[model samples]
Target: MGGDRDEGDSRMSNLTGLSDDLINAMNRHDLDGALRCYTEGAVYVSPVGVGEGRDEIASFLGAFLTAFPDVRWTPWSRVVVCGNVLITQWVITGTHHGPFSMPNGEIIEATGRCVNVRGCSLRTMDGDRIAVHCVFYDQLELYAQLGAELVLPRP
Candidate 1:
């Protein structure tokens, strides 16, 4: 039983390492590098939407990178690993000097705009690969800070 537990731990470590590598790749906008960390049938769910398979994930990231050329993520704390799951907290900082496409199909250029967003992710690993990932963040706060005019509900 001890040996089995050790093996599980080893697998968890490998998975956590893979997740770290993926984050690094994203910080660098290395699409290929990031894709390498995902399993062939990996799935990603973000506040924006869901992406199934590596190809879709690559496409989704590519579009975002194109809009935010200097996007970066700063890990705020060490990753917490458990079995095949890993949780990470991070802050993403980026400039919106280019055109951004909103989920409502509006594309607008935001010059000199900057955004600092706090986020967290839950990832499930298959061996050393990411099989599924779900990311959460405050989209409203991000947009508000980005200078979007807000309309509040009247009491």
Candidate 2:
């Protein structure tokens, strides 16, 4: 998963033109381009946390782009679009090469481990811009790949 590659990130987004625009921007490592795909009041949700508004979205993306500068979310399923919702499954591949911050504000240092995490996203579109985006992924798998196991409290 850590191999030098683009994670097959060139497919058109299923949501709308905005979706494709953001994917293209991310593949090109253009944060500004990616951010332009969302509206000012967009809400980005993930298993890690929810980021409301463009500022919060940028901050959330900053963490990801910082942690995995070459990260890519490769589509693993046909995009499903109904009404204003666009859903797709993906294989998120990346290498931990910098500080990775958790949703709870815990920052993990670089481990250089590569992760091929299976995940999915549901994006709701308002007109051509994204209104809300939700992603699902396993945090435990991500942490374990970086060499840490969850310490569950015994009952």
Candidate 3:
């Protein structure tokens, strides 16, 4: 039992390290470095949609960062690890300083809108590598604050 507990703690430490590395890579826009934190067959599911495998994940983030060059994530809480699962909470603060594409093929530039967003992620780890990551956030509030229409449903 003691050995198992030690192993779990070690795993948690590794996951925390990986999470920090990922955030650092994002801050530096080092997509390759970020990709190194995930397993080769890892999956990333963001608030927008799902991306399977490292290549797809990289491409998605690359385009996203290209559109939002100033995009940044600030972790407001420590990663909580349990067994093979890891949870992290963060606040993403960024300005619209570049082109952002709408779903209907509209491209808007530099709305100059600043966004303060609260979000969370769930990650499944295989050894020290992240195997699956899922992120959740409020897209409606983000869009509305960015000057988009408020399409919220009435209670």
Ranking by TM-score: 1, 3, 2
Residue pairs with colliding backbones in model 3 are none
Q: Which stretches of candidate 2 lie over 4 Å from their true place?
A: 1-16
45 Cα displacement, candidate 2 (Å): 0.8
Better model by TM-score, 1 or 2? 1
Per lDDT, the best of the predicted structures is 1
Report the C-alpha lDDT of model 3 over 1-155, residue by residue, as the tens digit: 99998987887788888899998999888999989989999999986567899999997788668766878988877665567787889987788777765555566667888887788888899887889999887877777767876454899
- For model 1, the local distance difference test gives 0.83
What lDDT score belongs to each candidate, Candidate 1 first? 0.83, 0.78, 0.81
Candidate 1, residue 21: the lDDT equals 95
The reply for model 1, stretches above 4 Å from the true place, is 1-5, 78-82, 152-155
Clashes of 2: 0
Q: Write down the RMSD of all candidates, one decimal each.
A: 2.4, 9.0, 3.0
Q: Candidate 3: where is the Cα deviation over 4 Å?
A: 79-81, 101-109, 150-155
- Deviation of model 2 at 66, angstroms: 0.2
TM-score of each: 0.86, 0.83, 0.85
